[model samples]
Target: MSHQAIYRKFRPKIFDDVLGQEHVTKTLKNQILSDNIAHAYLFSGIRGTGKTSTAKIFARAVNCTNSHDGNPCNECEICKSILDETNMDVIEMDAASNNGVEDIRELRDKVKFLPVKSKYKVYIIDEVHMLSKGAFNALLKTLEEPPEHLLFILATTEPQKIPATILSRCQRFDLKRIKSSVIVENMEKICQEINVKYDEKALKLIAANSEGAMRDALSILDRCVSFNNEEVDYETVINLLGTVNYQVVMEAASSLMDKSIEKTMILVDDILNSGKELSFFLDELIICFRNMLIIKTTNSTDNLMRVSEDEAEALKNASSKISVDEIVNYIEDLSTAQLECKRSLNPRVLLETKLIKMLHGVNHTDIETLTKRIEELENIIKSGNVPVARQSAKAAPSRQTAVHNDFPAQETRKTVVSEHAVKQETSHDTSNSVQEPRNFENKSDEAIFNAIINGWQAILKKVRSENAGLQAIIRESKLTEVVNKKAVFEFDPKFTFHINAANQPKNRQKFKDVISSFVNDNCEVEFISKREKEEKSNKPKQTIEDIYEDLKNEFGEEIVEFKQED
Candidate 1:
């Protein structure tokens, strides 16, 4: 006897044995029971989710003479022959290797012959998407209109590559990824049956790392079993797979949240020195943050599975120190780090830099929040809104008031803000430069042009604070001129559509309000294309009487006056 892998040894023998695909399996079982099975079936899903296994079991069940309740008894002769791969009626083909037109033509020739012994001839083609276009054309007619005793089961991980012509002719059954908890439970059952000693947490780590594939889980279990012959523990699993344990994830998260970079670096060094892959480490970090976020945001844990009680408790205790928004920000930051670390030359330094940024509180929302905080502080300081010193009036009879008592009374304004907000504001150099308001109504045209040009970045920020979506549209636009107190905006020829959109009444009003804050008066604005502005530059200016004649043409004679009153 030869040694067999755990996955192959425990291959599913029937539709009921397949895990994580009850939606597909149940439907096939009902079809079999009702004698309404289709001639052609297509099974598609991620790899190792039991497409091939289901096809094999369905083949056996359809040919079993003594099938019970749509399940092959496995005791009958026909089921035994099919299970042992000795049945002539059930033929399995690998479409990856046999994808040429000649191979498909030979298959077409074989389809004409009826089954020798079984009730039907079942052809199972795996990786069916690998079939060439010509091969697909050859099999199209047969797949669409096969003989009464023929059944074709096509399986592929990628169904998008298959032609829609063939896709529409078959009964397609989509499969889903197995849940981690389900994979864990199934592995536990297998471990008990094999009489192998294992830790519960160890199995969970395997399930999580398996990525929703039970076959992958079994393969990992086989490796663990080989590494530690009789007993598999938590240490064995992580060491073998180069994965971080839940303890490391919790401790690292705690160190980062507490801004203890030295301790976090030491932990990183320890993991890397132990040969753990940096990619997997980052993935574990993301999962840790996600789990903590779930516990903080949700009221129940029914939907969350595969998390241990101790881990959940640790996450809860850590959740109190950080906010839900902060946790979400952390997850997003780590998600980007995961991608960056993969492409970076030195992932260790990159990850360390990200940790430093996390300590400083970095994200999109931090910018706008910091701006508001600065405005609040500026108001408080200018108004002397602080706590005043206490004065003693009845202590002694003094000829003059004390220095503390002689000062003007200060009003207190309560402001609650984190130090991270201050740091975020301080990081941007322009946030500290508050421009003085200017009255542009009496100012010269050159002065207004300099104001709009010099203060453009500030105006952009203010507009961003109003609606963030406007920033993308107004990115490359500049103030080219100031004409008759109406600010003229010149946009590129490519931005013709944005010109009209930004000049809408509501958006134009919002722009005017932001500009009014700087100029101290209502600022009317007009957006024009570069070509239109150039064409207008080539034309001559009209006189006041010319503008009057145009007004009189619309409003009649009383509104128009060609001569002066003198």
Candidate 2:
């Protein structure tokens, strides 16, 4: 005889043999022991969860002539016949192939016949959800009230597709996904029975890859055995499955946390070049982050299923370097990427894009990002890196002018931020530059623009408190310039609605009022896209030196110093 597949060779023949479905098995066995049998039974669960196997076991147990504690005696003639597929009374059908109304009608017609050998004629239909609507209608009446000598067993991975009328007529049993621990134990028994050498960790890896499917686990084990016919080692399973190693995931995660884009991208390319599927590697990364989050929050690895103690410790060590909020954000972004990865033709590109975004911390407008930005500013201030400007009695009264004055007095009045913030205040073209005379009441465009950029968040918060819709419209807009008492906000060209909505009389007035209060100037608000800003200013952009000269003219050389951090 040809060698049989491991899954088929080790198929469960009795209730005791089916693993990880004790709930369904115990209930069915009790029904059999008490001589209480339902006409129709429905077993539903994910694939390889023993739905069809349980259906077959229940069918044989109900008809066994020599039953022991609600289990079929395999030695009995009837049980043997059914097990060998030689019993005419126990008919098995694949509803996926025979899903027409005519197929169900034939079964309805056959229900009237008496059993050929067994006490009851049992009909087992697998993938029963594949049946058509008309086929369901055809089977509804007979399933609702079958003949006393007949029984119906239906199994499906997807029970939702089955009609309600058919579902209500049968006793339903939901099988659960088998646990990895149970699967590993079963594989160990199989290996011991077959006299095959194996590593325990290899079995664990197989079980994890199977994703709670017993058949999948067995199939993977069969391949590994065929590959070596000796010891099934952890490395062999990893290579066969083309799964990313846990260490590789840890390294990539560390690179990301360190904000090392080059290292992360190189690691990604290496994984793909080594023939690992991008989706699988992506799934591993998501799981890795999720595990870290679990360990970080719960302070225990008890909830983790597949991670060993050593791996759990490594994860705990890694989790210490990142915050819980960062872990949550990574999980969310990676999960979204996973969904897109499925449909994407270039999954590698998609994966890299998500990784870059995560490394850069680019998710914007959310409360978490806002809070992170605030914390960073606070940290900079706490470190005493921020410069505080002082004023003397000889200084200008305007707060904006007082910021640039280099006074000997110890009285500090304004914060003169570093060049990083000042550089963000770009220099406009001299052709378009407003020639308004500088006064104590009106601030220089440089001061006003810097104030707008620095205080932008506070302005948004004020607007949010009064009108959230206005805040949302301006959320993506950058306050690029404050010229001629008109503040210009540049948004991405794709957000056309922002420009339209922000220009509305009520919204414009409300937003202008908030900005006026923020910068203490009655400035008019204007919204434009970056593309429009580019088009309006056709002159060559100013160089760094040109910007420096402009700042030097506005503020004295003492306050206009440039310091670059390494």
Candidate 3:
């Protein structure tokens, strides 16, 4: 006999055989048992979740010659005929290929006739969303008022694309993706039934690779079986599926955590030499980081990952050495690299750069440490362990000025003064020279500008610390001017709307508090457009309640509350 695909050969023959969809199966069973089945039924979910298979089972159950409870007796001729696709009463159509209006018109005309050899004439349409709009319109009336002996089963992965009119005529049931554990368990059972020897680790690898698709898992197992002739090993499974082994991923993660760029690069090179895809490597790295983050953040690992017990324990050990923040940074870097790799001509270079960055950039330090270091340096300077350079420079001018005061006769005697006294006299003379009228005025102006700059810096720091979302919007805002207790702020064009929205009364009050604490004034804050100066003046505004009361006296109770804040 020719080889049959695992998904096709092992398709669920009955409701009990369906996996990961107990809720749907139970509901359908109840409907069948109570004789309350709808004329049109819509089954929607991801592929391989048994939408089409469930429809076939339902067709068999409804038309079974020896129906028991809600299941079909496979021994019955009707069930055998339906399974063999030889029954005229049960029609199965692929809407993807037969999406023209003429096909739907023929179906509509056929639904009018009674069942020829079964209790119900069931039409199972797979990929119903692929039907053209005209085809949908043609099938609408017939679906709404089909014969009692006729049942229409529409299966689709995307129900959103189906029209509302067609949806309204049917009862919809959303099937769910089969969980990884369930797929693994079912694959093991299938392996046993087929006399295939496999390990649990191999099954998990296949299940995880399947990503919640039972058919995919079975197909992967089938491929493994074919490659090794019924004795599937973990290595064979990985090689057949082109999946990175968990150990390789773990080693890569460990290297990253230890900041071992050499080891990581070697591992990456090895995988690349093995002809593994860079994108797939990146995807695996992302998953590894995600698992690490989960292990770091959560205390329980019951349902978090689908790895075997030993693998989970290994991951937990790896996760213990790294912090959650580090994992998050690593994931973000890899994710960004993945996006960039898509657009780059050479993805290997991008991948290498990203790995190097992840290995080096995991250690993050904040600005607070730098600020404290600066403060420490200032304190050391203020402790008087060393003479101030500015003061020493001033001594020269002081000595020159003192020479002018004492005249040429004392110049020689002044040179013989003690070093301390000489230094003092020099500092005094330098102070006198430094405090010239014009120079003092310039210093005062500079001091004012410095103060304003410092105040703006403080405001920005507060905004970033308190409101990250807002800070992300207003990337760089500069203090344009301070006139008559009004602070003018100029924002980048990208942040114009953000600044305007934040300047609303409630947020403006918060901004005012931040600015007041920084500049030592309860000043009015005004925002000017970046391109033009249309200053929004902040004046003491009346409350909306007050305005409402005034309007109420003029217009009675019909007056409503309305207020706008600038």
Candidate 4:
């Protein structure tokens, strides 16, 4: 029996064997069949998504005498020779090792020669990004006017590093990360063929830990098989991969959500003591909240969730106890903490500290709950069914007298019988009313306006951080007014492009979201040109946002980036 690793043993022999990359493979197969293949090709993606394997297959397909539907017939002598790494015509060069001007010069010297056996010569260069600048220049020279009989297939994980000149010459195929479901299906088929027993959950766990790399998945499965005597179980997969159970993380989240300090601390201790990495545990916690957020929103365990029935049920049950906003905020908080831990030397202490804060932290979700309750109360009051507080007849008269003495604070009005409303009610004697604005009696319109003015720099800095390009566009804008969770932004008329862009559906939503976080509630944003606001209000005031809508509307998504003339 062959003792090669599972990844090597199960490498795709044909186009159909490659999973989750039909977009790339199918296109290549079509090109091969149509004889429209480019002289230079770039295969770019994350590792182990079959960049090199596909290159080999394509090389063999091009050289095969008996090609069937653009796929190489393995039985053909040319295809079999390439498959067994004996074909000199199909050269596989590891650019990572031979990435020098001399190596490239040697390659250039050989390119003039015709194919030894096949109709065309193919050079498959893996890790093409590693080639030196001089080597890239030399390679560019060769590709500038390539021989009709030569093909260059370059594969790399970091395509950004490749020179743009080199990139422009090749037809680039972007490979995407294989989804967990696709990986699991392949794993199950492999397990059946190999006669290895495995829990489906175990296979899924391996796939998740592989992070979209098929080779990584196979390597993980190999480890699982080795540890579990070819009979892999869920627990064995967990232990081997050091992956924290979703249930365990869910329980910890439950403790945090419940604000059970002791329970949270105990769970943290148990997790750390069990030999799991704190960073990985943090990742699992982040993912737990992320999944909770998904389940909280979608309310279904569709393809989005990659878990078994038991884990799905557990996630749903845990998610039901919390609001979507809570899950989002918790995920954000955990992500921040994870970043902090990564930067800090004492990660364990940081993790423990973060967990403690999570236990007692004042939840933003609570603010949302209060907001909703206040809205409901307002609706009830507007309907003229204010829930009046019961008291003796004596107390009612005293309360009435107090209403006449002064304007009651906004906090006092939440009790439903506002002093202003009561005075108007006694005089007019009517329950019907227009919607009363919920403004803090102490917090005047002028006060809210001034607060926004004072915090303009902080707001601008926030926008700057979110998108530097946007900041460049909206450098001359500011908040002009804020009332009832609605913010008005004034911008100079000359920069109408910025306003139109900022007011577009997407940029407007982003701007509103940032303002909401700043104002601690949902906020609606309105954009007005300085001149327009002045013409309407008969006063001039300077402000803030877009190459937004007009350019987008006029140019479409292929943004024309212009450079200043020197």
Candidate 5:
């Protein structure tokens, strides 16, 4: 006899043999026991989940002359006929190939005829979603009210594509993807039965790569066995799948956490030179990061992190060195790279680029990254090393502020000034801008403005929770200055819609309420155009040391301290 693939050779002949789908099989057996079988059935799930196998078994069970516990006795003539494909009563059709209106019409005409040898004729249509609209419509009448001697079993990976009219007339059963542990156990049994030497870890690696598909797992196992029929081990499986081992994965993750760019790149180079696929390695990297995150968050490995004790310990140690936020960002970057890797011709470069980015630094624009930076600054302040600017005679002095005589009071105004229009609108000399006059000498006002600037991200987060639309609009506006009880926001002239949106009566009030809660004062909000802001740009830019000194002054010595070296 010719060699048959393991998936086909070890195909489940009975419902009891189907793995990880007890909820479906048990109900089916009960239906058989009660003799309450439906005329039409719909089986749906991902591939290799045993939809067609279950359909075939159920068809045989209902026709078997000698049956036990809702199972078919293959010894019986009718059962053997169906198994051998000689029986005309049980017809299996691949709807993917025969999905035309005429095909369903042919089947509809056949439903009226009685079974040749069996009690009922069963029609199993796999990939039923591939049927055309006209084909589905043609199948509807026959499916809805088929002859008592006819049975229709429809299977599809996507049930949503099936017409509701066709779905309503059938008994639907959604099969689940088989678990990895179950696949491993079954594969181990196959190895023993075939007298092949194997490593338990090798079976697990295969199972993990199979992604909860029994047929995929078996197919992978077949290739591994073919490569070395005498034995299957971790090294063989890893090489066959083009994926790195757990040790390499852990080491790569460690290098990333340590920010050792050279070491990580060398590892990537070595893996590439060894003919390992970058995409598979990327997948391993993602799983490795996910496991570490799980360990970091839950502090437990039971049923979560699918690794050995040593691997779990390594993950725990590595996870300790990184924060949850950083790990999440790394996962996000790697996941995005993974998606792009499929389309890129040079996946190696893409993979290396993402790894380098994760190592270099976090995106400062991200809210979590900004929050982390603020926390780091606070820690520096508490440590008493806040920098102080050195005074030099030649250095420019702080500019003065001349109050605007026409400043509006108690009401918010939108200033849509252009470069040419600024002179006419301000109506005052701007060598010393008027916007800063109210807070120029009052250190308390300066402190309040600084405090709001530092807590800007938090305010945005609060606004996001309450009103996402408002937060989105105002996020583009910079809090340039806070004078009196009013807060001024500067928006890019192109984003004038943002200014207009924030100026609305209801949105403006909601934003005012949020800002008031943050500053512990009833604050009025104002939006200004970028052109108007530029007109008041006479303030001296602060040096790095000067900014640190301001932070120290605002947070106090206990929270922010700085030192200067001569």
Candidate 6:
């Protein structure tokens, strides 16, 4: 006999043999036992989740002559014929290849007749979503009112593409992706049955790489076995999949956590030299980081990493050195780099640049350190110990009362300003006459706007130095004005790229923070086109309570719980 792939060879012949789909199996079994079978059934989920296998098993179980407990007896003639694909009543069609209206019409015409021999005439259509619109319309009426003896089972990975009319007629059962732990357990059982020497770590690597697909995991295991001649090890599996070594990923993460760019780059270089794909390495790193995050945040191991207990403990230990925010940032960067690597002509260059950025990005600044520094500055400012030169100078009388002359209650404002100026100037000997008059006339608007423009220019320079594409777009952007604590930025129609970039929540928040720090105030920043009107009515005007409620809904209800802050 020719060699058969593991996935095909080990296809579930009975519902009990299906792994990681107990919900599906149990429900189908009860339906069969209670004689509540639907005329048309639709099975949907991610690929390799046993949608087709379950359909076949259902066909056999319903038609088997000598069936017990909702399971088919493989020894029966009907079961054997279906298994061999020679059953006259059970017809399997690939809708992907035969998707015309005529084909569906033919099936619809045939459904009016009774089964030739079996108890039920089963039509299994794989990838049913590929059927044409006319074909779907043709199938709709027949599927809704098929004969008592006729049954239809539609399977598709992309069920969303299927029209709602057809979907409403059939009973839908969404099969879930098989979990990694289930995949690992099943692989171990298969290895024991085949008498192959395999390590648990090798099984783990296969499961993780499978991405919750049982068939893919088994197929990978089949290749590993073929290469090693029945003795599968972790190194052999890694090499066969062209995956980065787990140790290498760990070392890279450790170096990043330690802020050792040199060590991380060396590890990256070694992986590249070995000809492993940078995209694949990034995917593996994401999984590694995900595992670390799970360990750090959750005390339970229910959905934790599907590795061995020892490996899980090791990940737990490693996760202790990094904060949750750092992990989130690292994953975000790697995920973005992975997406970019897919489109770049030189993936290696993109990968290297991203690694360098991850190792040295300003986002990596420790939050605890920043908070401590801010607290120290606040303490110094509170204690009246700041340098005398850093204090503000007094405002001149002309600039102070100029605005009041146009109104009437100007003396009161001037008196208040003079008192503040006296107190502020008493603490410092800085030049009060130089810029104080101009600032008093404008009341700090010009200074704030200049500071905002300077800060944005600096950020643009940094972005340009790192990413040329971003630089090309932001170069044409301009800062228009800062009014009512809102920084209004403008970009030309020729350079509309920053509009999309600024709309991203992360980028928007970063820009807002930078502008706020530059202006030295709790100001909001908004990016708008030059032609856009700054209508107060059109603004996103909302009370603080309303904003808090919206944020609570976005983040989670727990974020808004009342708490007394010290």
TM-score of 4: 0.66
- Residue 207: error of model 1 in Å? 1.2
Tell me, what's the RMSD of every candidate? Answer: 20.6, 15.5, 21.4, 19.3, 16.4, 14.2
**Following a full C-alpha superposition, what root-mean-square deviation does model 2 have from the true structure?**
15.5
Residue range 15-59, candidate 3, lDDT tens digits: 889999989888888888888989999999988788988999999
Tens-place lDDT digits, model 6, residues 219-313: 89888888886688999998999998777878777887886778878888898899898878888788788889887788776575666666666
Top-lDDT candidate index: 2
Per TM-score, what order, best first?
A: 6, 5, 2, 4, 1, 3
- Where model 2 places Cα greater than 4 Å from the true spot, the runs are 1-4, 299-304, 364-566
How close to the true structure is residue 487 of candidate 6, measured as C-alpha lDDT? 66
TM-score of each: 0.65, 0.68, 0.65, 0.66, 0.68, 0.69
**What tens-digit string does per-residue lDDT give for candidate 2 at 420-518?**
322222322222323344333566555677788898788889999999988999998988766545688988999999888987767777787777767
User: Which stretches of model 6 miss by more than 4 angstroms?
Assistant: 1-4, 364-369, 388-566
* Candidate 6 global CA lDDT score: 0.73
- Residue 35's lDDT in candidate 4: 90
Give per-candidate clash totals. Answer: 0, 0, 2, 6, 8, 0
* Model 4 steric clash total: 6
Go through the candidates in order and give each one's C-alpha lDDT: 0.75, 0.78, 0.72, 0.74, 0.76, 0.73
Query: Against the correct fold, how does model 2 do in TM-score?
Result: 0.68
Per-residue lDDT of candidate 5, residues 89-170 (tens digit): 9999999999999999998888899999999899999999999999999999897678888888999999999999999998
lDDT of 1 by residue, 102-170 (tens): 999999999889998898899999999999999999989798779999999999999999999999989
RMSD of 6: 14.2
On TM-score, the stronger of 4 and 6 is 6
Model 3 residue 123 CA deviation (Å) reads: 1.1
Which candidate model has the greater TM-score, 3 or 5? Answer: 5
Stretches of candidate 5 exceeding 4 Å from the true structure: 1-4, 299-310, 364-566
Q: Rank the candidates by lDDT, best first.
A: 2, 5, 1, 4, 6, 3
